[model samples]
Target: MRRLAYIRALLLVGLLLAQSRPAAAQTNLIRNPGFEAPYSAWGGIGPIQVAHEWTPWWSEQPDHNPPWYRPEWKPAEAQFFPNRVLSGERAQQWFTFHASHYAGMYQQVFNVVPGVRYQFSVYAQVWSSVEDDPYPSVLPANPRLQIGIDPTGNWNAFSGDIVWSGEAPMNAVIDQWGYMVVEATAQNNVITVFMKTSPDFANKHNDTYWDNANLIVAGQAPPPTNTPAPPTPIPSDTPVPPPTAVPSDTPVPPPTAVPSDTPVPPPTNTPAPATATLPPTATLPPTNTPIPPTETPEPTATEPPPTETPAPTNTATATATVEVILETIEPTEGPTALPAATEVVAADSGGSGAVAEPGEATGNPPAAVEEADSTAASSTILVVLVGGLALVLTVVVLLLVWRRITGAG
Candidate 1:
């Protein structure tokens, strides 16, 4: 007896120690778990069934019940409530989960920690029609509890396939609410819990009801609704930068290169005029290319190192006489010759004007050199502009023609 008593005492002490160790307590995380409150926060089509069960006249729309209560299966009869309740009208009544129409409801829980296991559970019941003449009451093969991690925390997050489908033994009574519980780990901050019906039958009346949802986080305290305000830091001229601050310095350097690039193109274009004019002047036969000799006269004035006026005057006279002779021959070259003549004159003026520019810079005048440089630049720009425009027009016509050919083919 003493030995037996000692054994019993030891067993009792073990039980006591186990109890004192403090098993983890789980708190329900779901808000509005019961549909008793207005489901304004709830998402999807089904409305809150304000119409009570058992009351023959109770309806989804009590005030305007007659017009809206027509069920598709039984067109002759109409009721305010959805199908039939699981139990007597008073004991069982809630939202209906219709598989045919994909009717369901979902609620989002915020501030959920990622990679943490959570216990999710809900109470639901299968709904069937009352009249069984041709149509008998049908229960769904599978009902589901969908728990998911939605980064956006939107209600539509549960709109896709369930992370996992679950099932529970349903009672024969239409109003009996059964338990469908599941365990899931959140992959994001906002976890969505949904009560959904399965698409098991082609024409199956897989209607179900849902109430009393529970979400519990294991081994952690529930998040508080009102988070404490962060501590204000001491004022400093150079504050610690935010993690989200973009590197403004990196983008600034790229824009600086564009301005440097823009100024470079114009300065580079200044030398282009010198090249275009030098070719025609170097291949000088005043009649061969009507414009060069006219330019040669201007340079002769500045070209000779000594007796600048007399030598330059003789050259100018010779150039003028040659241009007159070319103009007289221009009419014989036809209408084509008129444009050629104008082009030759423009090239001669610009080329010769540019040649005198260096002398003006040294001994003559700064303003004269600037004027000559400006004239040469203007003529070069005009020629380039005309050429670029013609090239662009040709490209546009070709693209349109190609598109039409491809479309026709």
Candidate 2:
């Protein structure tokens, strides 16, 4: 019975130890908050807003009229409340939202939540100067225009929820900037934006327009836009430097470019210095790319291994301590309230009805168990020693009798 109990205890201890572990370690991705400065890869017809940390405070759609720059919008455009202009030492535009100008959210990103409804919104008053003169503005005959969204998302429309209204003689108020915000929730998130007009400034030269928008969820701000995972790193076609003394007859292609800081050529007879080869990445090269050395110039120098590479000479080591984030168990909402560390203690103690996570094993001492094991070990030693001594004595006595009998009994 004791042996069976001991075996069961050992098995329980093993099971408890195996069950204690923290979270499986999930990967978390946080959006790059615009606060520290936003970045735009695309914002306009010619990608004008690429350099702009953000769009919206400015215009997203350009005037696509006779010349055909900006295209048709889904929503209608009936007025230009004041206008927007690029300010600051180095920006093309900065939105003003003082007593004079105010309207719309700054920027927007989207999300595909599993089981939640969603919608989008936008509103702004913007204008741009051409060479320092106010562009011409045209007014249509009809005054009462309906503001709703177009099914197609090509242009901004006056459809959906009416943000504001100006029934004629109010002047399409270009100077007095007003505000507008749309609110909607769809069963399925199929977001579409637009700008429609029976006839207004449906012409050209309207540079500073309004198109900053954001999706909203349950009255809360929208989530960040989900971008596809970047591709894996792999070697690609590295632009080679132009070769000097074009082979006898071959035409040398115009200077193709290379990344900056390539290895310098070696002296006529000397070896080249070690150069560094960059890792392949999906990120775009610097705005200004550098050129490589014209020729091999006598195998100047072998490139150095990438900085991220671990050297063979470096000692292999896991000695550096790792910080284990222990998982805290919340108390059960049921009748019983369990302590945060109780699970850890029970798991380590090999107790029942207790669960533990990795790195959360309690260091509670097991003095009684230790002393019991020690006593059992000591008893086993004494039994073996006594048995061996008795056997030795018996052997000696038998040997003596045999000797006597053989001699001459």
Candidate 3:
């Protein structure tokens, strides 16, 4: 009973330590990127090409830049400004959108990766035209603007399968442009855009203009967020070291003794018995009569055929193997609530950016995200409670069994 008590105490202490552990293990790591909104500044409009540094012209209104925007007139390389994706309905807004019209493509590969998501868009001209095809055709074979998985291998000109394809509209083609925005899988960082065919635009090869190519998070891992805090170039001055404290010697308590409770004895199932030696010379006669065996023919060794030695048979043994599996249980909410090493990734996801707290991370999870975390925490608590209850029930059952066996119930 006393041994059992010590075991229980130890288990309690262990569980307490477990509960007190910090969160944020590698297992809880999560990465998600958002959409890159239209760079038009306005809500919509596209199928325009910008140049100079090789950019794209955004589809915004009031600035037609054309009655058939002059080819030599050159436009701006349009890009989504408030880049990256939105979380959900409560999310600010998804950046992913599609393009409307098309002549050529503007393509570039970025060095910096923004957030955990990659952004891509498709533009097509349905009702209107830039070069204005005489006989407009809404063919399903409407050229696609592609984004391939070329890792800078085959640079300058992109080379790979067409990633962005726009479904051809019905025969109502007057020749105009449409838009479609999307977030690509973060695994591929390469970006490119070019018309699949030269139907409307005459010189498809030379006409595709792209500019203002901001490839955020191109080389580095995904950015914490699209609106990442601007980098501070100037380094701060060296911090002054605080003065070390001096130790003052006071009269220490002289060898105080700790008192221990007396150890309890374990209960025994049976009483100890006295021992005696057996007499070597005394031969006791058997009182009980033994049944006689029926007579049967017994073969002599010489009469029997020469016996053959038996082959070695496989021996079976009562053996057991113990295996330990480290099921690194992760908290459902995420990593523990303690500071992690620099190697651990922290999602600095937010439009506001992460403001460093005095001794903690500045970012707060969105309301939706917080709700998910709370649900996870409740689940963990429920599991622990059920486990504890089961253990207590087992102990009670054991006690009842002992009482019944000893007739002490």
lDDT of each: 0.40, 0.29, 0.28
Tens-digit lDDT track of model 2 for 1-409:
9999999999999988888854343211112221122324233332223233222211222122111111211121223322331111121222211001111112222333434433333223333222224533222122111122222221222223222222212133232222323333332323333222222222222222333333445345344334222122111112122112112221112121121112221121122122222233433354224323435433233322322232311311211111111111122132122233344346556666545444444345354335444555565566555555555655565555455444432
Please provide TM-scores, in order, for all candidate models, with all chains considered together: 0.33, 0.24, 0.22
lDDT of 1 by residue, 259-282 (tens): 211212222233468888898888
Can you list the residue pairs that collide in candidate 1? 53-89, 54-89, 86-174, 86-175, 87-175
TM-score of 1: 0.33
Model 3 is weakest, by summed lDDT over 10 consecutive residues, at 315-324
| RMSD of every prediction | 32.4, 49.0, 58.3
Candidate 2: segments with Cα more than 4 A from true spot: 1-47, 50-68, 71-109, 112-119, 128-173, 189-204, 211-214, 218-409
Best by TM-score: 1
Q: After superposition, how far is residue 263 of candidate 3 from its true place, in Å?
A: 99
lDDT of 3: 0.28
- Cα lDDT tens digits for candidate 3, 1-409: 9999999999999999999986432210111111122223111223221222233221111122110121221222223321111221111111101112222323454442433434333332322222223234222222233222222312322233233333333232123233333333333444443322222221111122211112332223322333323322111122222112121212111111110011111111011111112232233323222322223223333222322311111110101010011112232325433233211223334335333343554344344345555656676666556556655665565555545444521
**Model 1 residue 145 lDDT?**
24
lDDT over C-alpha atoms for residue 230 of model 3 = 30
Model 3 RMSD in Å is: 58.3
